[model samples]
Target chain A: MRDDEEMGRITLAQVAQKAGVSISTVSKVLNGRQDVAPPTRIKVERLLETHAYRRTARSSREAPLIEIVFHELDSIWALELIRGVENVAKANQASVVLTESGTRHSPDPDWIEGVLQRRPIGVVLVFSALPQAVKQQLRARSIPFVIIDPAGDPDPDVPSVGSANWTGGLAATRHLIELGHRRIGIITGPEDMLCSLARLDGYRSAMSMAGLETAPELIRFGDFHVEGGYDRAMEMLSLPERPTAVFAGSDLQALGVLEAARVNGLRVPHDLSVVGYDDVQVARWSSPALTTVHQPLRQMAEEAAQMLLRLRTEEPSSTRLELATSLVVRKSTAPPRAD
Target chain B: MRDDEEMGRITLAQVAQKAGVSISTVSKVLNGRQDVAPPTRIKVERLLETHAYRRTARSSREAPLIEIVFHELDSIWALELIRGVENVAKANQASVVLTESGTRHSPDPDWIEGVLQRRPIGVVLVFSALPQAVKQQLRARSIPFVIIDPAGDPDPDVPSVGSANWTGGLAATRHLIELGHRRIGIITGPEDMLCSLARLDGYRSAMSMAGLETAPELIRFGDFHVEGGYDRAMEMLSLPERPTAVFAGSDLQALGVLEAARVNGLRVPHDLSVVGYDDVQVARWSSPALTTVHQPLRQMAEEAAQMLLRLRTEEPSSTRLELATSLVVRKSTAPPRAD
Candidate 1:
């Protein structure tokens, strides 16, 4: 085979003549264009395998290519995750395609169908909630995929990779509690995301553990954005019983909180305390540097990519890997002042 | 032809028979796998084309995928650029493959070559200065590419999209001059990058315009990183004839300069006026908001993608597009205190 390492380019007519079929029938079967009958398709596939034709560099092959799709492109966190996927794919000599899913309210079914029809190796969905119909379609095709930070239902069988977001949330809340701040406010990400739910759960659990009463009025929903965080913080501060400490679901949100505090003439630590998540680069640079929960983003992304590659090569493993999270004690977190 | 689109598939034997060549010769010519006589190769190609036999997607139709290669994944600026590229790609219905072009000092050429062989639709080079051999290889294959912020000798023919970095530098320097700063210091990115040169040009242009002699000791080289900026600022501030205004090439570097100012008991604007570039999100959030040069990053990226797509479609056009840069006035810049 190495002698003719690249020499086996056979034409469809030769195969068709040998199989006693019209060139059109053979072409239809070989191209996998839907017009062909199943029997004809199978026959052509067998001939293809036996003859060992070389594929063009530009064409999609019988073997699928895995695609990793993300919702946001601006965040360093997303890029790190992508690096992880790339590392794994490189090791396996497999190519991974990346695309942005956009911020549309509904996932485009036509787009999903077109991608799947190309017979990708598998899909590593980044920050998308799979619709039931899409899931059903994938299931029918028996195409393997892994979801990262799915916004909706979590299928028990589908593999997923994420940080210990719940623990991260709990750690952030506990740090505030330990600072003797009873009036703590929370600014959270979109309610639809699983990470947001987990973070909320962690905050609740931490509050419960500290024997603190939950104040529904102290919590506000932000879209995990800087502006959202600022607006939410302003709302919290205007309350008659304001929170002395605030926990933001993301570092961007925390910065927003800081701005809100500044505009209100409140000094950090002396007037307010804050904690954030993801520990992105800006966390350490901002004034009164954000106290954040560090998610092992790079590690998690690498592991997810490796897991997807493994699933492609071996039988699907029944194991799920959850990376750890840690609290970075920065200036944003401090003891409450004696008012 | 539209109605009989399914009839385009034909076999190697038919092509070989029509071209009056052996099946092996036809295979070699089609696959470009082996050395074939030029006449025979051309004959086989014409025969295959005339018969309307389309290459199967499974057969090496060199995959039309394009790759976006970055030099460093950890840099926040790079991440933002990636986001811009992602947004544009999504709109164009194109897939982008991401890869790290390895480290800054010692890029892996072999890794890049292997990727090129995979036959992507095209490539968008981000942040890395590609090696000469790699550029030559791409040229040999006639692969269309677009580069962003290339450091090394970029191919003269490849389309490039970049911000007006030189003008940005001049604006920062001139802003300081307008505010009555006679002694000004500058922090710059890697010396090898064109941006570094452009920024230097801007600084000199502004200083000459202000009738201030370009002092040899006033300029420092930094890696366009926070730590580098901090270290350089500290050195410049401790001088006997310290500068009252410092212009940094990047927002992260500006933050570093601010930190150094704080440690040295110098107040921003009041004691030391600072101007930075790339009005990244952090510039506005910092305690004393940084006045910097704003690069229309989103537009630049979208334009870059459009350029690559045009090239991929074989549309010849200009090799470079220079986007505008504007100065964003903020608290970090102000008039120097008069003794």
Candidate 2:
């Protein structure tokens, strides 16, 4: 479907005529100018999408730029992703244009206009899902984009990069089980996220395989942030029979668990054991450091950027690339004390 | 001198003639084209510099881009600074171009070429100093730039924004002193950086003011990283008469100190008190949380970005702006336990 332009089957004039608009108006719409009325713009966009009109490769005279859009720039994961894209862009002698826009689902509507006008080599979106309209707009302009979907929910049509969440969860739980912890708790991400559910299922599988009971009271959902981890940990700690070990979903959440334990007068790895996912820099820098799942965020971003560059020249072999997640043994996890 | 171009005191043709180069050659140099010979490029550059040939204000037709160049994007402060610039750039409806280039002192020579062609609205550099040649090129092209100097080293001629390192040092020290800590040690940054010296001095002042002798063994210069903090802290903790509290000069260093104390079987704020500088995210995320100095890194970057915009329309009222730092008391510090 993306190759219709390779056959030279569509032209701007044809799209303009079909949309009942002037060639200049079509050009304006293509450039994302706001002057065009909504109706006309929608009509032109539909025509372009139907024809799959891919813009020609950018001229060499323009400085090569790669655009990376993030819904939330404040995320702890932002730096790793930016560095990944930056690494690839630098290697290609291209600069990175960063935009913080939109919700977790898609970029803001206004963002597309600037992107169209800039005519970057490609775009890398740190979003779980791309709005269909936005996807069509980018596809019509031949702006190849790949989503760095750390959330593990990949749209089948869009090329995406994610990590092995289930494997990460299985390994984390198995490590604790091997250390002779029978009653282990799991604090996964929001219930709505696929990664969280995947991790939870992995934990449940590990517990069942080890002949241990999966107690409902020992399972919880978290916001994947520090405060949420602390709150959930405190609740479990107050239980009459609290779990001896916990898998704290994300590194930020893991820090909260560490703090919660401190507040509860329990020493990490001695009175309680905590494991975090996402081996972000903070994982290593945390007080006792954290035993975490290495989600390969940077490598995932690098792969996404590389995939965008690849899509520009050739058809992708696969639309989804799920990298492996490994366990990192640090200071946070240990055997539960004898009664 | 910057107003010479506004007064139309120089022309490209005249500069080309003076340099004995063709107008086209001068134009290529202006565009940062690499085809020109070294001698010709330098000759044309000198003539342009002599005449103060500021390129006319960029055409509004071009995309408004704000460039931010960092020598090391891996620094923990990078995110805060990027957020600050991103905040301002978004407000102005300008996209941000991020470049990781050069060293701590200046950007690489090749970096200027792309900047020349991109012709961003302005540039915000995250470096302690800019080479004379790079400064000349930027000035000749009328591309205003401001440095975000967290290192506390500001070139006299360049507009820069920095924080009050000395004051931050004083605040952290006084917080410890007020907590009844008579014997305190400090782990400041590298000895060469002015900020490190300033912070060390602040610690010294606080100690002297409290009628305490500043022991040579208690003051240690560190690399301002976690490992450095850990090594120095271990050395200090091993002293015959160890400090009751330690002031770690940076958040990363403070993390190291926490680990060191843990290894020594000393509880934070109980067996030992610890205070950190730079209240970065990690400071708050650490097990006990760190009592530290709040360096307004994001604000400093915002000011630098704001300064660049102001430079486009008017001369800066002051070339150097130093934001204040304050103390943030958290869980890390307490009165020294009775020996």
Candidate 3:
């Protein structure tokens, strides 16, 4: 029994060394990353199974369970996204592990290492803007995974899931436009984020569609947080020719916009029309109820979890899933009048 | 090299078997959990060191990491509580592992086993109404843990951290009394929770202090959710002798109160005053900012994490730490008007 236990505990590095492949290739095989060649992948996988095969905590004797790795970046928005993911994981009986990629000051590598060492059937990368080099490392290891909101370009073969961010942005802009607002302003997330760019594109597209010129002064940047939104809104509202309508990239930012409006004695929809994206729970409860675009957060999370599960099970990857978005017309938005 | 690798991998289970002790005793020795006799504990520790026994992951190499297990009871309010815990855990350089305790229908023991096998330095239980038998099991294992908003009495030695619920209730009720409100209502959380009981006690105490009679019709039962708060608030307001002020146990519930007020055409602080507990982020942003008892959520989480860390480190367990609470005067509360 002791000998069996000792021999059964094979580290991935040892398997990689013995197979005359990079640790990544061995990882790719173990993770069922489909980019690898069939013969080489099979050989490595066979070796892995023979050496350290262990069923996942959720899996039956035959089926392997994928693990969803949630890296919460200090945001309450992550919680809603997690609920969406957990709902899907529970339905599928796949195991999910939640961890925080420590705050910006001290980025610990232990979280990543722990997930890798666990050798989960597959992984779902949730809200991780992992550096390119780290992403490359993960790819090289051929860790079967799908990025929900990855910082980099999506792999052609690996499945990815996200909302129709650009459309949502356009919808938010159009809502203000339909309210007869020409002098519309926009507050967006960090410029580096893909969603931020996509949302901005949507806003510009909507403005152009209305034959309205974009006002350079009306645009501002926020870090996709309530405080960031609040500060940026303050800056925008303080301008000489303040915008009549404000489009915020997130609901939290919209709240900030509301606060800024209140501080400036601007009545919502009466003095300032505001539209927000990601219509999180706060949107419905906030006073004047935020007019916003609803990101199919739950659907996106569920699809991503399913995609990761398929990858872990060595099933064929599905095409990228782009969920739809819709505008939830609420009291926060109104037509701009000649005040 | 293979033989050396094999020789170095000695699981604690092996050490426990060899030393003729329970896995709990071996774990206690490894983690320095001090309930065990000094001699037996030292014997196990010596065996582990002599054999060069290593924990499965490198997590063991670092100072013990604590886990804040969120017993997700399908309540959104838990999200803010988690945020509080995460903030503290991050500040302390301790990693938090989030796990969903099964709901009423799916009670699985595997969740507990998974956390235990990981050998977390300690655990911070949040809002989990764990059964007494399970608590006994945890106690028997001698795992150092702290329960936050626990549903039942924890082992005497295991420390707990929570807000001053009784005081919060009193503060809310007194705020109403000062407003010349004779008929005030209360919306409470689940009957089984200790916090709910404390909050009820405070409300009763405040009414007694004010020489005001408690109206049976004014008290309503809620599940500490927005919908529950909303329904209960509606019920209270519909009464012939309606309450002039309503104190809710949670912010989510308070939101429901606001909705109820809106539906009933009641102007806040004009016709009805509302006070809520645990001033979550939404409380500040709500239309008429909520007048709430600010439960030091972040501080409570930090204190709980600190307590768990101390317990895991073989330090003497301190008696329960009761964090302070304060009443945040906001737009939601005001003096009751004479009809």
Which portions of model 2 show Cα errors greater than 4 Å?
Answer: A1-8, A316-318, B1-8, B316-318
In Å, residue A27's CA in model 3 sits off its true spot by 14
Q: Per-residue lDDT for B1-339 in model 2, tens only?
A: 556556557888998888888899999999998999988888888778767677877677556899999998889999899989989988988899999999999998888988998889889999987898898888777788998898999899889899999988888988888989888999999999999999999998888888889899999999999999999999999999988999999999999999999999898989888888888898888889899899999999899888988887895443889999999999999998876
Q: Judge candidate 1 at residue A84 and give its lDDT.
A: 72
In model 2, residue pairs whose N, Cα or C atoms come closer than 3 Å (at least 3 residues apart or on different chains), thus clashing, are: none
Per-residue lDDT for B97-184 in model 3, tens only? 5565666322355555555455566677764445653454344344567777523333455477766778888988898888788888
lDDT of 2 at A251: 96
Which has the better lDDT: candidate 1, or candidate 3? 1
Name the fnat for model 3.
0.18
Candidate 3 yields a Cα-based lDDT of: 0.70
Question: Candidate 3's residue-wise lDDT over A173-254, tens digit each?
Answer: 9888888999999998898777888888899999999999999988888887777778998998889988999998888889
> Which candidate's lDDT is highest?
2
The number of clashing residue pairs in each candidate reads 25, 0, 3
The Cα error of candidate 3 at residue B216, in Å, is 4.7
Best by TM-score: 2
